[model samples]
Every structure is written in structure tokens, then in C-alpha cells.
Target: MNNIITIRFSALLILLVAALVTACKKGDNNALTPDLGTRVAGKYTYSELKTGGKTYPASDTNLKGTITLTRQTPTTVAIQLAIVHKATNEAFADDAAEDVDVVEAASGTIELHYNGDTIAKINGSKISIEGEDDAGTVFTLFATK
Candidate 1:
């Protein structure tokens, strides 16, 4: 009788532990959502700094631009910026796609880097980027879906 009771208690203990672990995993945010790089894949209207430190908005007027992000790999993303001339209604700048590495994705924050440049830091649907132009002028970019 003593041995049977001990065996039943051990089995119940193991079952309780398993149930608690499963419940905790269901509540884990990281396990519930996709990675940051994958979550950030979408179209964004951005504001960029032009040559001579001029700011351009991605509105209908001025030099409208859009940033498209695509997931390249588990830890990499393809970024493309397309800009159009407002007057001529033609493409002004459409550069080749650049690949950026995902640095960190934790606690609802994401950071990406490209050629040692801080390409983007994202929180939720908002993103901020910092880069330097050819003329050594620092530029900041902000975007949203």
C-alpha cells in the first residue's frame, strides 16, 4: 500500500509540472508572435533627407517615396526605396535592393544593421532609421505602415 501511494504521488507531481510548463509557454509573447524582421515586412511611407540637408516627405506632393521590406532569410531582410518625381510623375530614385541583418528582436523591439549603419529600429509599427550621406551629413528617417 505504501509503495502504491508513493507511485501515485510521483505521477501526479509530474503531471502537475507538465501542465504548469504548458500554461507558461502559452503566455510567452516571444513564442506567440513571429520574429521582428518578419513582422516588419510591409510597405512604409517615409521621410528622408535629401542632399544639402533638405527633408522630403513621402506625400503626394514633393518627392514621394515608399520603402518596401521583404524577408530574405531568417535573419536578413531586403530593403528597397522607391521615389517618384512629383512634377514629371516619373521614378526619381529606385535603387537596388539592399540586405540588412537583424541585430535584435526582443520584447517588441527590433533593430537592424546594414554595412555597419544603423538601418532601422522598430517598435510595433513605427520605425526609425539613421544613416550618413556621401557628403558626411547625418540623416534620420521615420516611417509607418
Candidate 2:
């Protein structure tokens, strides 16, 4: 009778252990969905190409003012660039809004695309964008949070 009771208790213990193991197993769906806008949305100090191997800050008289990024959608964002007069400290162009699609790659890199062309790639807190303006001149923008 004691042997029978011990056998039954061991079987129940084994079943409980198996159940707990199965319940504690991690699932493949534990990966988090990337939110690009929440990660990259902020005001950044903007810099761009000025001339041959030269760069200028956005506050420069020839360049625009600060660049602002706001989230429009899960995959899209709006850019607002301010153009100001340095001496007068007046904003001549307060709003130049442009929309671009943002993609978060599986490798944890963020890409900003305009008109189906990749304009920027962001890694960590640094962002670099390269594209051409309407005047057919190539420009590269670097920004940091």
C-alpha cells in the first residue's frame, strides 16, 4: 500500500512539473513592434553641405533655421524647417512642411524615404540624409538629437 501511494505521488509530481515547464516556455511572438516616430521624433540641430567639402549650420544666414520632426502616421512624418534672418532674429519662413515615409528595418536602423527614394538613415541618436533639391544640386544633411 505504501509503495502504491509513493508511485501515485511521483506520477502526479512529474505531471505538475511538465505542466509548469510548458506554461513557462517563451513564445516566438515576444518580439516588440518597432515604433519609428516615437524613436526619432524630436528637434535636431541641422547641418548641411554648403560648398565643396564645406558644411554650414542651419543657423547660418545662407541656410535655414532649426529642423523639427513630427509624426504624421505610423510610417510617415512631417518635417518643418524654419528659415530665419540671423541679424534681425526674425523668421522669414516659419513653415516649410514636407512629408516623408519612415521605415524601421529589422536590423534596428531607421530610414526616411521621400518619393520612394531613401533620403535618410538613422542610427542611434545620429541621422544623416542625402538628396537633391529642385535646383539639381546634391545636398547632405546631418543632424543630432
Candidate 3:
């Protein structure tokens, strides 16, 4: 019984150390410190938009817009984007984007929900988006903000 108790205590100690190490490694994420607004605030230029085999070009490589992001809590950032209408000819599941809600974590990855409808997943420092655009044209935004 004494031996079993000692073994259990050692196991618990090991587990506790492991947890502490993990927490320390992710300390920055838990800090809830958001990047300076201007550092992450800018328009990213998108190059290609594809649907089927054909690729649609952005009316403007520049996505004129405004985005406000706040670090709601550690590891979570709430972002709102006000995109200007391009008047580009494209159709989508009605709801014609008025705005988009995006949430980006410290992972530097952003998930965009357009007009409270479709969700687009974007990755990388260059901000490459892989998903259908609001106009139903396949869009891969290579722009960086």
C-alpha cells in the first residue's frame, strides 16, 4: 500500500510538471495582447478567383475596407470589417454582403463569416483564403493585412 501511494504521488507530480510546461509554452496566447491595430490594419491584394476552371479577377487588387479588431480575451480576437462595394458582376446566395465578421486568434488564422452567412477560412501570414467568395466565384485571397 505504501509503495502504491508513492507511485501515485510521483505520477501526479509528473503530470503537474507537464501541465506547467505546456502552459508556459503557450504563455503569449494566454496574455490576451492583441497586435497593434495599425500593424494588422491594411488592405491585402488578392490575385486569383476561380470557379470551375475559369478564374475571375478582382475588380481591384486592393480590397478597400476598414477593419476593427479587439482582443476580447486571451487567444481570441474579434474583428469587424467594413468592405466597400466593388459593383463587380457576381452572384451569391442572396444577402449581398453589407459587412463581414471575422475572428482571429493568436494563431494568426482568421475565419470570416460574410453577412452572417458563409464562412471562409483563411490562413498564413500572406492571408490566403480558400473558399467561395460572396459572389459564388471561388476566391483565394492572397492579400495581407
Candidate 4:
């Protein structure tokens, strides 16, 4: 009777250990959702900029732009803008870049807002922002991861 009980207990213990080993993953668990800040923090390269009745493609000599995004809070992201879209000779001022709140619009889409305006969005590896200069010239910037 002792041998049978010991054998059953050892088998049960082995099964429990196997179950735990399989349940605990070594890295980030896909079942867990990442915070909004972490979900959108990354570097995005400019794809294009449209303004002044013209669209500047990334292939343009002076249209190259890259922005870095950092996690500020669970619902905010700080954007570092380094861009020179020569088509309109528009340069982002030092104070133009700001931290913005983010909201998950959909499963894979996150919208960025500033001063109650929707300024940008992160859709998977792509990001897009729209803004106007002092002169009221509206411009849209598109980038990708």
C-alpha cells in the first residue's frame, strides 16, 4: 500500500511540474496586453508629406524625416520630430514637438491627440500626423516603422 501511494504521488507531482513549466513562458506573454505607451514607442521614417497643394514624396531630396517616439505614460507618448520638408520650407520648431495623449481607436489603431485635436495615429507599423503652421497651411506627415 505504501509503495502504491508513493508511486501515485510521484506521478502526480511530475504532472503538476510539467503543467507549470508549460504554463509559464520565458518572455513576454502574448496573452497579456501591453500598455498604450509601450505599444506605440518606436522610430518611424517619413513616407511622405502633403501640403500647399503638393505632395512631397520621400524620394524628394529634402523630404527625408524621422521621428522617435518614447513612452511617457500609459496613455501618453512623447514625440521627437526631426524633419525638413523643403517643398514648403516648413521646419518643425523646437517647441512644436510635444507629448500627446493616445487612445486605442481599434484593435491595431491608436490615435494621438493634442489640445483636444486628433493630430496623429499609430496603425501597426505606420504612423501619420496632421497639423497646420502659423500661416494655416495644413500638412500631413506619414511614416512607418
Worst 10-residue lDDT window, candidate 4: 89-98
Tell me how far the alpha carbon of residue 71 in candidate 2 is from the true structure, in angstroms, after superposition.
Answer: 2.1
lDDT string for model 3 (1-145, tens) is: 9999999999999999999988875355734754433234344444444456765555534343433444433323345434444465332222223234555656766665555543544555344444566566665434444
Name the lDDT value of residue 68 in candidate 3. 40
- Poorest stretch of ten by lDDT in candidate 3: 89-98
In the range 1-145, model 1's lDDT, one tens digit per residue, is 9999999999999999999988874466667677656887888776654334666655623666677889887677888867567777676546545578877655767887888876678776766766564577776666777
- As a TM-score, model 3 comes out at 0.33
- Model 1 worst lDDT window (10 residues): 48-57
Off by over 4 Å in 4: 1-31, 51-56, 85-99, 133-136
After best superposition, candidate 2 residue 7: deviation in angstroms? 2.3
Q: Estimate each model's TM-score.
A: 0.58, 0.60, 0.33, 0.65
> Order of all candidates by TM-score, from best down to worst?
4, 2, 1, 3
Model 4's alpha-carbon lDDT is: 0.80
Better of 1 and 2 by lDDT: 1
The candidate scoring highest on lDDT is 4
Off-target runs (Cα >4 Å) in candidate 2 are 25-31, 47-51, 55-65, 83-86, 90-95, 104-109, 130-139
In candidate 4, the residue pairs with backbone N, CA or C atoms under 3 Å apart (3 or more residues apart, or in different chains) clash, namely none
Q: Give the winner by TM-score.
A: 4
Model 1 per-residue lDDT at 60: 28
How well is each residue in 9-56 modelled by candidate 4, as lDDT tens digits?
A: 999999999999999869867648889888888888888778887877
Off by over 4 Å in 3: 1-29, 32-40, 54-99, 104-109, 126-142
| Model 3 pairs in collision | none
